[model samples]
Structure formats: C-alpha cells, structure tokens
Target: MWNHNYEDELIKCHRFAVGLAKEIDYKNQRLLEMEHKYNETMATVCRLKEEVKSKDTRFLEMKQKYNESSATVKRLMNETDLLHSEMRKTQSINRKPDEALKCKKKELDQQAKELEESKAHNDLERRSFLNDIEKLKEELQAQEEKTDAIENLNSVLLVKEHMINQELQEARKESIESLQNMLTGRSKLGIKRMGEVDWKPFGDICSQKFPGEDWAKISAELCSEWQEKLKNPHWHPFKKVMENDEPQEQIDEGDEDLKELKTKWGEDVYEAVTKALLEMNEVNASGSYAVPEIWNLMEDRRASMKEIIQYIIKQLRAHMRKRKRC
Candidate 1:
C-alpha cells in the first residue's frame, strides 16, 4: 500500500511537470508572436516613412511642373493679346483699306487658331495637374490613416506587452515560491518589491509651474538658482576628490561634484534633481529619452559640469524607463 501511494505521488508530480512544460511552451509561443508582430509593425512604419518621403518628392515635382505650365500659359496669353493690338492698329490705319483688311483678317484667323490650340493645351495640362494633385491628396490621406492605425497598434502593443511582462514575472515568482514551499513544507513564501514613489510633488509642479516654456531651460535656471543659494558648493567634480586629505577609491558611478554635494547636503537631493528632469523631459508627451545616445554626446574624460547634469538627468531617465517597463 505504501509503494502504491508513492507511485501515485510520482504520477501526480510527472503530470505537474508536463503541465508546467506545456505552459512554458505556450508562453514562449506568445512571446515569439509578440516579437513577430513588433517587427512587422516596425517594418510597416519604415515603409510608410519611405512612402511619405516619395510622396513629398512627387508633390514637389508636380508643383514645379505646374509652375512651368503656368508660365507657358501666361506667355501664350500675352502673344494673343499682342495679336489683338495689331488688329486694332490695322483698323485705325487708312492706307490700302480693302487689301490691308483682307491681309489683317487672314493673319488674325491664323493667330486665333494658334491661340485656340494653346488654350486647349493649357486646359489639358491644368486638368492633368489637378488630377495628379487629387491623387497626391488621396495618398496623403491614406498615409495619415495608416499613421493613426500604427499609433493605435503601438498603444495596444505597449499595453499587451506590459500585461505579458507582469504575467511572466508573476508566473516565475509563483514557480520559485512553489519549489521553496515544497522544500520547506511551508504554505506561504513572502516576496515584495519596493514601495511606490510619491508622485504628488511632481504632479503639483506639473500643474502649477511654467506651462508653455521649455522646462529644460527652466530646470537649468532652477539649478543655477540652487547653486546661488548654496554659499560654498563645488562647481567642479575633481575638486571634491582633491579636497580630501586621504586618497579615495575610484568612484563606481556619479559625478564627483554631485557626489560632494550629496556629502554636503543629503542623498535624497536626487529626488529634487530627478523631479526637475522629469518635468523638463516631458516624457509622457514624448517617450523614453535615450541615455546611451546622450552619453555618446560627451567623451567620458572631457565632459563639463553642464554635461554632467545632462548625464545625471539621462541616468534618471534610464531608471525611469526601466521602472516603467517593469
């Protein structure tokens, strides 16, 4: 009976393993599908961008053609006017009345034919231009619609990606907790992430502060104001290292000047700096600010204090992006 019970337990564990394997396979399949969809969307966006460029080029070319056609029409109309002037001058003359009248009438008829031909050609060209313009407008409208669709798709994908990521994390956490529970023979395994950041100050600033101005400049100005308020603050980072009597270990991260300020003030000063950057970044309106790109703008050894601020802001931005992604 004990052996039979052991066998029954083994069968149950095998079934559990199989179910887990099947679930993992399903998750993997879903991940692949999401990645495939993402790639396809990016390709479509690139294609649309190229199409927009081509459309702009075509529009410019059409505009040039239309301008040339207009010039030609103007010249032809002027010629027709000149012929009318000549006819008026002939009518005013008294010499060789019948002969001159007959000659003038023949010339006028020939000129009229040329004028009619020119007018017909101009009308045809105008119609062609209008048709092409209408076609171009249609293309632009279609492009706009596609852009809206892409934006909507991106929004949906972002949300779905978030949900999937959360599900994946929860699944992994549950799996780990299950193994631990089995080993320890406990019903509960306590695990939790960091507490939420207080966004009330940030929200208040967004609501009350400079509405239309460039927030970066405002932040820069605020930074300057803070420096003015601090009677004796290290402007240069290297100065802080030099001020110390004892040689310090190499900093793993952070600018020396900012680090010194942190030593002088509090570590939580970052919250203030971060708040300013967040306001300046306008990330909700735009998207994630690329930190690697910003870092590249400065050569590591030669960057200034101002650049250091930018680097710090970017670091904060990178952190924000990671937090938001998670």
Candidate 2:
C-alpha cells in the first residue's frame, strides 16, 4: 500500500479547503450586504437627526415668539387699566366745573380713539400668535409621528440582522453536516436548490380567474428599478402583513341563488362585467348593457351594476391599459 493514510489526509484537507473557501465567500458577501444596509440606515438616521435638530430650532424660535406675544398682551392689558383709571380721574375733574371743557372733551375723545386702535392692534397680534402656536403644535405632532416611524424602521432592521445571523448559523451547521457526510463513507450527497418565483405570471393567473380584479392596477404602479426594492427580505407584502394579519371570517347569509351564482363564477363574472363596462367604446357599452349576458348577472342579484359603471365612467376614463413595460 503506497501511503493510503496520507492520501486520505490529502483528500480531507482538499475538502476542508473547499469548504473554507465557500464559507469565506459566503461571509464576505454577507458582510458587504450588511455594510451596505448599515450605511443606508446610518444615512437615514443622520437625515432624521438633522430634521429633528431643525425642528427643535424652529420650536425654540416659536417658543420665543409666543413669550414675546404674551409679554405684549400683558403690556396692552396694563395700558388699558391705566387708561381706564385716567379716564375716571378726567371725568371727576370735568364734573368740578372745568374752564376748557370743549378742549378737555376733545382731548378725551382723541385718547379714547387711540385706545380703541391700540386694543384692535392688540387683538390682531393675539390672534396671530394663537394661529402660530396652533401651526407649531401641528408641526411638532407631525415630527413626533415621523420619529415614531423611524424607530419602527430601526426595530425592523434589528430583526432583519437577527434573522441574518440565524441564517449564517444554519448555513455553518449545514456545511459541517455536509463535511461529516463526505467523511463518513457516504456514497452519495444530494443537493437541493431554491428556484425563483416570478410574480407577474402568478398575478396574471389571479387576474384571469378574476378579470374584474384590476390587473392594470399592478402595472400602473410599476416604476423604474422598483424591483431592486424586493432585494430586502423584509420588504415583501406578505412578510409585512404576516405579523398583524387577523383574518376575519364572516358568513354572508344573503340570497342563496345569488350566493350560488357568485360561488360558481367566482370573480370572473364581475371581471367580465368590469371589462365590458370599462374597456368598450360608448356605442359598444350602450349596446352591451342591453345584452342579457351583461345585465342578467347583476339583475339576478337584484343589484344595479349599471349605476356603478356609469359612476366610474363619469369619475374617470374607465379602461384597462395593457401592461407594456413591466
């Protein structure tokens, strides 16, 4: 035997080197991803902090303005009290046989007019201050809400990091297991791969099954490079709603025949009607409404589908635009 143990050692070393390389690559990729996310999150946090700082500055300015307004109001009130006391003293003097009564009366009238103008100005300033305070309060509330949303985002990020760590651990465990299999005189190793699921085809399937289901709606919302957002595992619609989704199962005890009709057709009939109502030209729409196939579906349920069709038509040009870009 030409060093059989040495050959075995060499084989084991090769396998270890391969596994180590793979593990390193995996770790490096994950590190890059985590760094990217960290940078982005840090940027967001920085932006929010700047916003908060600005808001605080504005709030302080507002507080100063409010204080100034309060002081102004207090000064005006004190002036009013002094004016009333002076007017009383003038009245008493007038009652004691004044020489320049007309002159005194004219002076008193002028003073009263000035006082009225001052009061009006004071009232206007008070109203302005109150309005400013209200606006400030609204802004503060909005800022607080934004802060709350940011905190929630941070929490989500933390959860994502935790999940990623768990995934790395699992990958390591699996790698160890694979290595163990290779060493234990196992003849075969089977590998499983995850395939990608295309959403558009699935949406199309859903659309056809329920034609009135607004396939165009999804296409309408699609924009440039929007799919890049899907890279974030936490961003999926189902993942988002998974935590809080409480399905409310309710039984509809309406007309049995109508319910039966709905159950038989599912969403397709409604879609067909939607297509007829929405996509057709005016002449076609009017002509199709008269057809038994179009109206009978709704008529059986004792519902006026025509009204809703008319309403939508009046609201917007009701037509399903073909998906071109997405």
The parts of candidate 2 lying over 4 Å away from their true place are 1-99, 183-326
lDDT of 2 by residue, 1-326 (tens): 56998899999999999999999999999999999999999999999999888874664565566566566656666666675676678788766644465565566566656656665665666677679989999999999999999999999999999998897656544543443323222212222111111235335545665587676565333311123232333322221123347743222325353245346544443233223322232213222222111122223321133433443354344233323322
User: If scored against the real structure, what TM-score would every candidate get?
Assistant: 0.29, 0.27
RMSD of each: 35.4, 36.4
Error of 1 at 19 (Å): 99
What overall lDDT goes with each candidate model? 0.54, 0.51
- Per-model tally of clashing residue pairs: 1, 1
Q: Least accurate stretch of 10 residues (summed lDDT) in model 2?
A: 188-197
Lowest-sum lDDT 10-residue window in model 1:
287-296
Error of 2 at 107 (Å): 1.1
Top lDDT hit: 1
Query: Model 1: per-residue lDDT, tens digit, 243-303?
Result: 3588533332366555554564444544554333333233121212211111122232222
